[model samples]
Target: MTELSHEGERLQKVLAAAGVASRRVSEQLIAAGRVTVNGVVVTELGSRVDPLVDKVAVDGSAVQLDPDKRYVMLNKPTGVLSSMSDERGRPDLRAFTAEYPERLFNVGRLDSDTSGLLLLTNDGELAHVLAHPSFGVTKTYIATVTGTATPATMRRLEAGLELDDGPIAADRARVVGEPSRGRSIVEVTLHSGRNRIVRRMLDAVGLPVVELVRRQFGPLHLGTLGVGRTRDLTRVELGQLLTLSREPGRPRSGIGAPDAAGTAMDDDESDSE
Candidate 1:
């Protein structure tokens, strides 16, 4: 765990800046008596703090500032939801986190049944910024379809299809390697994180997706990473990812951004849970 910031600030303010959550959420922790300064529960709304030297605990654990951020890349397995703890008690990414001492959360979600590269981190603000829809950190996937999707299918995907809700499209769609008999391995890269957008798009065209495995997200790629295995994010990789837009208080600008009526990032963004 990193040391708490010694900088002059309120305990709650430091926690929020450390990415524990937003400032408003931090206040709630204080109200619930979850925050403590120097070993005493602090219910005061305006308690001052010095993260650098004072010990602050939230729910009995220290909230420290880590000068060096930690980033993890995991080849998430199918059937486990993307969460810190699962009420259903089903298997999750926590299986490989024994060595990680700091509290962590998913960078983005992968569907319970979709297996692919997943990011986990202790830095709250980085996760929030990366998960923000405006970033559109493009992701790539290799999907097996139920039926043959010829050059025409490729064009259809490129042209984008209309769904019951709205139009869905792929940023780049190409056949991987040579198409096998009755099966075509296709590589799809998209910036929009819509719910099952790939499957839905093909389904609408009568080429339902059978198996989907993500190969890349932003600058991170699965490559030969074995399924269910986890790895550390290289400094270079993390640096590249940080270049993504983290525009605050507004949705990302583009056709990929959801409609005016929409509330959250589109559907494809979730593959884990």
Candidate 2:
């Protein structure tokens, strides 16, 4: 792009800006012989693009800057895997997107078995920032545990538990709801993006998270949005998120953790890795 100056820019940046894939992922698409410039395979990372004149294609569809970016929040039900596509032919988010005009990918993730709030977007840069651990987006979840969590256990969790990866700590946890009568419900909130951190955290303290549901992430909440449905975020909502991205007080980890479990929707966490 620097070389082009008054002419074409590099292809990878253009694709990333177009909400296709991350720059790294775009490079893979280019190298795998999936991308072409002006109908010619341009596998070279140095391939430049003249957006005004040259056409880029991936899998035969022309890639260009979409006029409008889509950012949606969905109450994802269980069964959908966290992937753009599934090789095993399992059902995915595409089923809920029949009316969508542009292709969008999930922002964070909801594992195949879990269900709850999921963000889908065509803005790769925003996705990159939002999903980055450094941003420390707090996620609130209601987890069904095998047994009641005692004060000592809660204190241990808040202070930090010794996990294989490291001492896993939560910002908050408390049980204040009813579910199935005898069993206690707890709500937990944390900012880290460790693999199955919520489930793992509960497991280490002798409380197994039987069912995990993410009710909130950062500035967004799983309000009245029904399961399997979605809606776009307002501009102001997006502005708040952007503002959060610029804040420093929000630690990279432990930014938000609620201590309790109840009244939260399940979510797919398979994509967290």
Question: Which structure among the candidates has the greatest lDDT?
Answer: 2
| lDDT, candidate 2, 161-200, per-residue tens | 8889887789998775654644667888888777778888
lDDT for 39 in candidate 1 is: 63
Q: Give per-model CA RMSD.
A: 12.6, 13.5
* lDDT by residue (tens digit), candidate 1, 1-273: 233443477766778886667889999998898877766778776677765455566655455544445778888887876665666787766786667886556766777777788887766556655666666678888888766767677777888888887987888887766667677778888877667777777778777777888889888988788988888876456545644432234233332322222112333546334
Candidate 1 local lDDT, residue 4: 43
What are the lDDT scores of the predictions, listed in order? 0.68, 0.69
Query: Which stretches of candidate 1 lie above 4 Å from their native place?
Result: 1-68, 245-273
lDDT of 1: 0.68
Task: Please give the distance, in angstroms, between residue 235's alpha carbon in candidate 1 and its true position after superposition.
Answer: 1.2
Roughly what TM-score does model 2 have, to 2 decimal places?
0.65
TM-score, every prediction: 0.67, 0.65
Cα shift from native, residue 22, model 1 (Å): 35
